[model samples]
Target: MGGGAWKRGGSSCRPTTTAVGEPVVLPTVTVEDVRRVGLPPSTANLQPAGGHVVLNVPVNVYAQAAPVTRQVEVLGFPVTIRATPEAFTWTFGDGGALGPTADPGAPYPAMSTTHTYTRPGTYPITLTTTYSAEYAIAGLPFQPVDGTVDVSAPAATVTAHEGTTVLVR
Candidate 1:
């Protein structure tokens, strides 16, 4: 040795490594609360002599964090009411007898329409609303997320009452 004496069993060599950086947390999507409201109490059992049945559905939808757009449709036996975020249309029977067009006189935040039932019978009417939101993560709009709700008409009983006589048999 030129400078100093070397030790044979003094220390042992070991490998070393290094980390890049801290982990990143990405943003997530969360659906807000949704609500629905209907006009005319959503229940009517009347013995109309003849004519069509007109129903009005007033809907209110809100989102806490993001803006949401939705489509609504009323499903029934003799009729079907369909509405998009921009417009609404009504169809009669199984055919496209009515419309898929927009009505300028319809209400906002709510959709209202008149349905004509050809015959008198009990119908299970359902109003369905679907909501969706558009979001972008990396400068590109991703696929939208959606939600829906279906409301059915209440069961009704119809009977005629005659004057005085108490018909209990």
Candidate 2:
């Protein structure tokens, strides 16, 4: 009880137990607490992960993050929260938008999250990423909060052109 008790400025799991020795689960974090402790999701300088994709093909787009986690004091408990990519919404810049893909999308030919160009042209593609965060306190289990953050990537151009095919007679 002395060494494992949770306290301020501490960063470890300190599980609480009930009178019957059953593990006491922390209540789901309140919506207000999420705003207080979690940093808004960020998609730094959004761009297609791979440049120069073909028309009518799947292109992979992704965001970069370094340990997307945050530590903050909630109410009176020190809490740790981690942000994870939940979905992606893409605007193809051609007056068309594709969206909310659960898959992070693969490269051409293997992309589940992709769009097709109808004409040969240069289009600016914009992507919005939705991030979901979970919180853990006093070594307790992590629980998802009713929090989400959407970050948009700067529009990057992807040129799509038609392939030429001529018959030799």
Taken over the whole model, the C-alpha lDDT of each candidate is: 0.28, 0.61
Model 1 agreement with the true structure over 44-114: per-residue lDDT tens digits: 22223222232221111111121234322212112111212322232233232223223322333333343
- lDDT of model number 1: 0.28
lDDT of 2 by residue, 21-96 (tens): 8874444454444445544433523224445655555455554433367776554657777778777787877888
**Measured by TM-score, how close is model 2 to the native structure?**
0.59
| Model 2 local distance difference test score | 0.61
The TM-score measured for candidate 1 stands at 0.28
All candidates: CA RMSD in angstroms? 22.8, 8.4
Measured by lDDT, the strongest candidate is 2
Q: Quick one: how many clashes does candidate 1 have? A: 0
TM-score for each of the candidates: 0.28, 0.59
